[model samples]
Structures are given as C-alpha cells and as structure tokens.
Target: MRTKVSKGKMAKLLSVVDRTWRAAGFKIVQARPKLPSLSAAAPDGCIVKFSVGGFGQVRFDAGVGAISPGRGFHVEGEEGDTFPKAPNGGPDYTPDVQDRYWSK
Candidate 1:
C-alpha cells in the first residue's frame, strides 16, 4: 500500500528541490504553492517541471533526457528523529527512489 505525503512535508520537499536546482544552476521560472507544478528553465531555454505523483512520489521531466533522483534523497521524520518514517507512519520500508534531479 502507498501513503500520501502530508502538505507540510511536501512543502519542505519542494523547498529542498528548489534550492538544489538553483544550486545546480537552473533558473526558477515559477514556484507557486497553489499550483501543482514547479517549473524551471534550463540555460538552453528548455523548461523542466517537477510535480507530485499521484502516489506522493516526486516526478521529474526534462525535455532532453531522462531524469532520476540523485544521491541523498530520502524523507525523514521531524528534526529530532534519527530514522526515516514509512508512509504508513511505521518503520520505513519504502525503497529510496531519487527525489532530486540534476543535470550532468
């Protein structure tokens, strides 16, 4: 079974993604909370979109190539917790998929 990510957690994740993309040199075209999409434009004028998948997974789409999550992308509990929480709010058993994407 899959669990949905909470709104607060989703916001945090999106913020992280925004920072990561900016650090990777992508310009943020727009990032609106009301909208379900976060759009960024590449240096070459290509627009990339990041959206929340129906199952609460992070999805990435780049016009040129396939994008996948990079290293160190995992969701953990509140700041004080030392371990990640499962979507079911139990022990984390979910496989780690790339949550952040960067161009090489």
Candidate 2:
C-alpha cells in the first residue's frame, strides 16, 4: 500500500522530525530569519524561524535546505509533540525560537 501527502503536510512533517532529533540531545542547527518583535507582523502561516550554528540557517516555510548533520540520528517532531509553550504569546507553535550567541 501507498499513501500521498501535500506540501503543507510535508512541511509540518519535516518540522516534527527536526524537533524530535533536537529533543534526543541532537541539534538541528540552521540560520533562521530574525524577528523584530513578538507582537510584530509575521509572515503568512509562519510558525517560527531560527539559526543553527553547525547546521546552517533555514526558514521552514519560505526557504529550503538540507537537514543539519548532528551527533545523533535523523528524527523530527509531530504536530502534537510535547514542547514548552512560551508565555506572553511568544509564538503559536511548539519548540520556541532560540539562538546561541557569544560575545566578549
């Protein structure tokens, strides 16, 4: 048997996979778009965007790229995946957008 999926579905699916891998001590490092503010206008249907140090950068809905190679296996998160919800209405999705910066 075989099954088909839509572009939206595929995007969501890929997000899930990336989330799962990150949870398992693996990092999906990718560069994501910068947001001016939480209350600012976001792209249409855009859930989140971020950048990974080693995996490069990517925008889930707008751009495309390869999944960053990590020290673990390949995985992603489903729609119902358990992730911390940021308070003050940060983003309307799981896996909060975060980044690591170092400066002297």
Candidate 3:
C-alpha cells in the first residue's frame, strides 16, 4: 500500500531511510539511472539486500512508483509485500501498487 507523503517532507523521509539503511551497512544501487522505473527510488531497489533478522538477508525494493512530483511517491518494498494477500477474501494490498501521495 502507498501513502501520500507531501513532497516537502519527501526529502526528510528519504534521508531517514537512506541513513538507516546505510547505518545498517547496506549499499543502495540503481539499475537504470536513465528512465528509472521506480521513481524516487534509492538507486535500483532490485539490488538492495536488507537483513530481516532471523529471516536472513531478504532482498527488498525501495522505490516509489506513480510519482506525482511535489505531491507524493510510491514505494514498493517487494512484490509480495507491496501486494500482500488480503484477509477475509478481500482485495490484496491497498493500492495494489507502491506509491506515495503528497499529503500537503
């Protein structure tokens, strides 16, 4: 599911995520620098490997799609997570896409 995060606060949020991941010794790399598929992504979310505690090193995607600059961006942690199975036979993940909307 995606959340609408104001563009003004986007930088702050990205900074926090960057610092947190970097502090964890994770290097963020991009796949296609040019025509990036994941808008406002930390490099290529495809190569980001995150430590999921006992779950071992689970690769995660940290890119926001469907970007509305100055509005909000979408973030897809992973396909499964991004589109998690729904409960009570309801729809899957909210938005079914990872994106962030500008709250402001």
Top-TM-score structure, candidate number: 1
Alpha-carbon lDDT, every model: 0.64, 0.34, 0.41
For model 2, give the 10-residue run with minimal summed lDDT. 33-42
Which residue pairs come into collision in candidate 1?
69-98
Better of 2 and 3 by TM-score: 3
Consecutive 10-residue window with the lowest summed lDDT within model 3? 50-59
lDDT tens per residue, model 1, 1-104: 12344554677667887888889889999887654568898786677887876545556677854345666555575354343687788776332444232200
Query: Could you give me the TM-score of model 2 versus the true structure?
Result: 0.25
Scored by Cα lDDT, where does model 1 land? 0.64
Candidate with best lDDT: 1
Query: Which run of 10 residues does model 1 get worst, by summed lDDT?
Result: 95-104
lDDT of 3 by residue, 39-83 (tens): 222443323432221212112344335534586555686344334
TM-score of every prediction relative to native? 0.49, 0.25, 0.34
- Candidate 3 root-mean-square deviation in Å: 15.6
